[model samples]
Target: MEKNQSLVEENEKLSRGLSEAAGQTAQMLERIILTEQANEKMNAKLEELRKHAACKVDLQKLVETLEDQELKENVEVIRNLQQVITQLSDETVACMAAAIDTAVEPEAQVEISPGSSRSSDAFTTQHALRQAQMSKELVELNKALALKEALAKKMTQNDSQLQPIEFQYQDNIKNLELEVINLQKEKEELVLELQTTKKDVNQAKLSERRRKRLQELEGQIADLKKKLNEQSKLLKLKESTEHTVSKLNQEIRVMKNQRVQLMRQMKEDAERFRQWKQQKDKEVIQLKERDRKRQYELLKLERSFQKQSNVLRRKTEEAAAANKRLKDALQKQREVTEKRKETQSRGMEGTTARVKSWLGNEIEVMVSTEEAKRHLNDLLEDRKILAQDVAQLKEKVESGENPPPKLRRRTFSLAELRGQVSESEDSITKQIESLETEMELRSAQIADLQQKLLDAESEDRPKHRWENIATILEAKCALKYLIGELVSSKIQVSKLESSLKQNKASCADMQKMLFEERNHFAEIETELQAELVRVEQQHQEKVLYLLSQLQQSQMAEKQLEESVSEKEQQLLSILKCQDEELEKMQEVCEQNQQLLRENKIMKQKLNLLQVASRQKSHLPKDTLLSPDSSFEYIPPKPKPSRFKEKFLEQSMDIEDIKYCSEYSVNEPEDSDGDGGDGDDEEWKPTKLVKVSKKNIQ
Candidate 1:
């Protein structure tokens, strides 16, 4: 019952835990959804900000245009606009950071929980970890939201600040537009004035000074054009030369590549040859070693043969001494038999014959030993010849030539010679052993003969001593021959060493010459390169100088053009002022002529009145009553004066003047039937005369 209660309790705890986990998961999902929504809102706001930024960019482009037009006064406005853009960008960055933080936090919190929940303990641990992560993420999200709100407030503040600037910028734009319009109007007026001046200048005859200036300007323009053509030709030539140089350089590069490939091929061939040579050298060395071993073996054999020959010579000397002792002993016995035969005649005869036969046998044994010595000397000569043949064969093999049939035959002969030598050596050893054994037996016999002849051989001992001296002389001659051979070999070695040293010296000289040639070639190359560089620099300098000259000529041309335009404008203004002064003078001359004409009319009227008064006094009152007695007075014609003629000519030359005739008032002629003298008194002459003015075209 107790176990069952415990199990029920555990089951209830597990259920409670699962309920808490489900609630946590639900809250997490809600937070995730909220974060996603916030991200969406932030993205939309960012898009709106991007649109505003694009508008600002357009404004920036306008400011840049103004700058290009040299509107320095608007620098401050451009700076303010740039500052606003920077502030907005900074705000957008901050908002984006906040949005990213908010969006990433929930995902990070969810990821914090382990994927697998294999046991209750693991599930509980995962839940706890998730809960902790969620709390941290919530705090981070709240901070991000606060940051975002603060950024929004800053943006609003910046927008408020930017509003007045935008208004001012618009106002500045309007003012600039007005200034541009005024400038355009002024430009139009100047253009019109220039056109009128140009027309006048073209229509009027140019003064001598102006004509000269125009001719000079044309000449200068022609010269400039010619220079430009020349420069262009030179540039074309330079371009062609540069193209040819490039082609040459390309060819040189190709040649260098070919050379490099050739050098590589040569190096590969040299390496292959060197490898082949090394293999051949190794074979030669092996052959030399084999020859050296064979020679060493031959030397050992020769040494052994020489020792055996010495031993045989000693044995031969010992046998000669034994024979000499036996000869002495027999001579003494012969002397005794002769004395005994003289005393006992016929019985001693047989004994004397036996003694003579024994002496003949000893001489035959000495002849056999001399024959054996001659055979051994013959064998030694044959061995030396074989050795020489082997040396020649080895030389042929080391010379790196294919062996001919003769050489192959010689190699076979050498093997045969080797076999023959070994066989002869064995035979010689057997012969030496037999001679040693024979010498021992002869020594024993010599000892017995020496005992027998001890009393009788003192006289023959000098001859035996002379024979030993001859043997010693022969051994000394052999030693001298060997010493002579050694001296000759030493001379040959010294000659070889000298030749090798000379070869080395010659090789060193050749190498030095090669090094010097390489250095000379390198120096020549360096000098050529330096010369090429100097030429290039000179060419570049010439090009630069020509360009500068061309630029200066262009500037001079512009200056001359400006000066000519200014001079033309000055000349035009002078002409206009002169024309106005001439018109004024013409008006003054016309006024003077009208005043003179009026003066002439007044004088004529005065003369006529004076004449009428004189006639009235001369006639009687009674005669004046008659009509037939009245006289008519005529006015004289006015003659043209020189000054008037001159003035009229001048006015005619200047402009055409038209004259109109005015009505002349003539004094009333006396009536034919007039009865009243009082009628003449009542008709007074009118004084007012109308003068017409001439119109000058």
Candidate 2:
């Protein structure tokens, strides 16, 4: 039983050892994985460092190709120092990694044997030492990386500083190149000037008169230059004023066009008024002609009526004379009859039959006389009615109303009335001749009857006497009635003659008035013609004056243009002279730079030789010249003063020209103050003139 218990305890001890060995091996494998991860991280860091080292080498090569010798040498020194530092850091890191690998390989081999605890303890201690060494190496590598980063920062700072210096150097080189080109131009100009001087010297030596002439020409040239400057100033002022002047011209043209339109309108209105007046006058003349013709027709009618009344009056006078004669004869017969009756009373019974026959004859005579009296009365009534009609017609004609239809029909032209009056006179004459023939026959019968009655009275005087006495009384009554009608007709004729005289007077007055009106119209026409002629003359004069003024203004504008052109030419010449002066200045700057370079070179050489002599101790100090004595300071020539004087003169001339222009522009306004009346009253010219004056000022 004791042998079996001892065997069980040995088996328990073997199992415990195996479990411990397995746990230790698992721990070692975990540590190895951790170490491999650390190694991969270190390798990535080294590759980054190698890439940075390669960029630094490229920078060194770029710096070696620099144009500046001093900067290139400095960059080379910094680049070599950085490369040596990087190589030392890389070698140290590689050695540390190799020692860590050698130490870890033995720790891994010893860990595989699970029976030896002392060997495992020794492996742990060695691994600890290797980890400590690796830690120290990592610290050193980190310090080296920090140093490299600081160097890169310093190098970048240096490169940043040098970039601006290089840009400045390039700028200075370009400036020098430009200066050299300008210097060449100046050299050419100087050669031309020298040639000209030589010519002038030769001409001066040839004749004293020529030298005096050259001086005179120089003085003239100076004067011309002054004039040119003044002209240029004036041209500038003129250019500024041209816009205003052109605007004024446009306004003037517009105003002139308006004026022309207004004049045309006025002329049209005048012509229309004249035509209307002429038309009205023609109408008035036509009316007057119509009135004159009417009056003439009325006068003709009156004349015809007067002629008819005169003929009627003559007929009445003739009738009255015949009646008077008949009455006288009748009275004589009645006396004779009474005497016969007295003689017959003594023998009353002797002749009774003879007295009855005589009474019958006397009764026939009384009936004839009564019939003639009735005819005369009818004629008188006709004359009275005709007279009344004539009076009414005269009244209507005088009152200027239309005549009655009867009068209108009776009215005739002058020629027709004259012919009618002649025809009526001829008819009246024929009637009077017939009446006289009948009266002669009746008178003869009366004579024969008187003879018969004397014979019968002797036989029976008492019987016939009473009947003859009664017949004589009746005849006397008839004769008295005819005489009254004749007197009335004579009075009416006289009234008609008076009215005709008054009508004649009125016609004469009307004719005189017509003549006077014609004279007045003629006088008015003459006056209108005279006024029209005068107005036309005034308009012509005004137009001519305006044309002349326009011509003068145009001429002035042409002169201004010519002056402007001349000024422009002078300005071009002045600009060319300024360019030449700029070239001369550039040449002077180039000379200054060359002299400074020579002085610096001489100083450097003197310092070097002095240092060499001191080292050799053989060369004498007296042989080399002193720095200050070797280089003589020669000052550059001063710039010409004429250009500055010309600039100042040009400025002064511009001011003077401005003042002159102002004065000239204002002068016209002062002069124009007087002629404000007459045609100058036109608004366009005055306003334009004023505007021009204001703009110029």
Candidate 3:
């Protein structure tokens, strides 16, 4: 029992040790698991950041492409504008030459003389028409110039608008820079964390010795269990033997008790006989001794009586002395009480006098109760009057009568009035200030509205000019056959200049848009770069986390390997035990085979005896020896059934089953001997030989 308990304790201790190791391993595994989760999260974030960066890069490229296209358009527009300007300049020069020629022709016509009357009339009229046309063209040119000036003003306003957008972009860039700085700081922090995690991972590495130790411990435990099992089996056998021995011991004890009882009875009989013989002799001696003891006891009693009388005398004398001392003490106590009584009586008399004197002293108050009562009465009377006044006021309010007006107006002195005027002036000043502020706001609003109106007007002016151009085209087409070509040329020059101005304005707007877009793209790039840095830091942290997890997994793997080795050891022990059991089973099988052969021979002899009995009983011997009757009388044999044979044939190879089939057929023939032993043996062997031959064939 002690050994079993000790083994159990050892097992418990080993289990505890194993659990501790498992706990440590589990803790490491959990740490790894947590780190892996963190790594996964970081990976996801990194992927998101990468995706976002990719999207931003794509957008930036698209913006750049757009800007390039806009730049090309602007360049085209500028080129067209320049070409138009040049064309206009050329047309202007031609118009000036035409005007000079017309002026010179008129003078030449006047110089030619009035003798050619028809030529004079035609020249004068044509000259007047040309001058009128020139004047009209000049007016149109002035209008065009004014329109150009307005366009220039609009362009300036557009430039001013672009300035604010540029400022906004600059501010955005500044903010993005600040954000990038913050991201850099964060990245630095993350890097530090990653480094720390990496250090933790490095520090957490499991040593090879620990795993080896665990495996050794597991092997020892398995060995202990096997030993304990063997010991327990031996103990069981010992206990069985001990139990039989204890039974024999109990029977022996019963016989020993009977013998002991007989011996005790004999010893008791001898002791009784001896005690009676000694009692007669002791009685005679005791009588002699009794006489002498009675004499001595009488003397002793007389001496004790004298000693008691002496002690009583001594006690009486001591009691008298004590009584005398007590009497003196009582007298002294009486004397002390009398003196105390006199002093106490004197103190009581003095206390009574002091109490009387204190009672005789009276206190005087300054005010009389009657005066206080009178004051209280006066307050009560006043309260009554106020109550009456309130009642009257309430009644008047209920009757809807207006209360008497409080005349707050007073005749003002010059100083007071001056103060009042100053206050009014201050209020007026404040009002003026507010009005001025409102006017400023209104002016700003009006200016904005005016700018918008100008922009709208500028935008509409081109449509108006185009309409005018259309009108001019119609009019020119109507007069094309009649009008001089100079006027038409002037009109075309104006149209070209208008188109050039329009293109220039459009180019300016496109340039501004491209600038804004570029600024925006730059900000986006900075933001994306910051995000990428953050993602990289996160990725680094994740890598560190993964390393930690890998360390933890390695630790777990070592633990698992130890467990697997332990399991293998356990399996090996089980296999050894199974092998021993198989050996035992094989021995039992050999014995069973011997028993079976004896039973078979006995069965054959019984069959012969039954046949002889049947013949003596006048029954047919064939009937007793028939297969059906034999099967009925005999016990079942250990032969393989048809199903089992078929199953074995299907499961094994054909060659293996061929030999097995011979044995199987012989088992049935042996169980039901169809003839004598020799005949049966010969017949079965022949059949087996034929089957074997067929299998070989």
Per residue, candidate 3 scores C-alpha lDDT tens digits across 605-665 of 6556545533433446576467766334433333446634653533334444555556555
- How far residue 254's Cα lies from its native spot in candidate 1, in Å, is 2.1
lDDT of each: 0.52, 0.49, 0.46
Q: Is candidate 1 or candidate 3 better by lDDT?
A: 1
What TM-score, computed on C-alpha atoms, does each candidate reach? 0.24, 0.24, 0.12
Name the regions of candidate 2 deviating beyond 4 angstroms: 1-224, 230-266, 342-375, 387-697
Q: What is residue 174's positional error in candidate 3, in angstroms?
A: 98
The candidate with the higher TM-score, 1 or 3, is 1
Candidate 2 structure quality by residue, lDDT tens digits, 1-697: 6886456445434433433443343344335435645854775575467557553566566695798988888777777766766786678566655544454343433333333233222333333333333333333333343343334434444555565755665565556556555655555554455446544656546545544544565565556555555555654554454554455456545543553454344345435544755665676566445546655654676686566556655555544554544454455456545655665543333233234334433443454355345435545454455555545545554564532121222223334334544553454344345445444543444444444334433545446545543444434543444466468779999899999889999988999999999999999999999999999999999999999999999988998988898898899889889989888676645544443454345446544544443343333435333454332343432233432343234333344334434543443344335433341222111111111222121
Q: Write the per-residue lDDT of candidate 1 for residues 1-697, one digit (tens) a residue.
A: 8897567556445533543553464455456546656865875675566456443554555655664555644654665766765676678667656655565454454453344333233434444454544444444544444454445555555555566755665565566556555655555554454445543554344343454555564565556555555555655655565565555556545543553454344345435545755665676566555655655655665576567557656755655565564555456545644554464333333333333333333333334334333433443443454345445445544563311111112112234435544654454445445545544554454454444444333566435423321244434544554476579889999999999999999999999999999999999999999999999999999999999999999999999999998999999999988988888877766765664565466557745764665566466867655667443332333322432353465344323222211112222333212424544443334343443445332
Candidate 1 residue pairs in clash (backbone atoms < 3 Å)? none
TM-score of predicted model 1?
A: 0.24
- Give the distance in Å from residue 213's predicted Cα in candidate 1 to where it truly belongs: 6.3
lDDT of 1 at 481: 49
The number of residue pairs in model 1 that clash at the backbone is 0
Question: Order of candidates by lDDT, top first?
Answer: 1, 2, 3
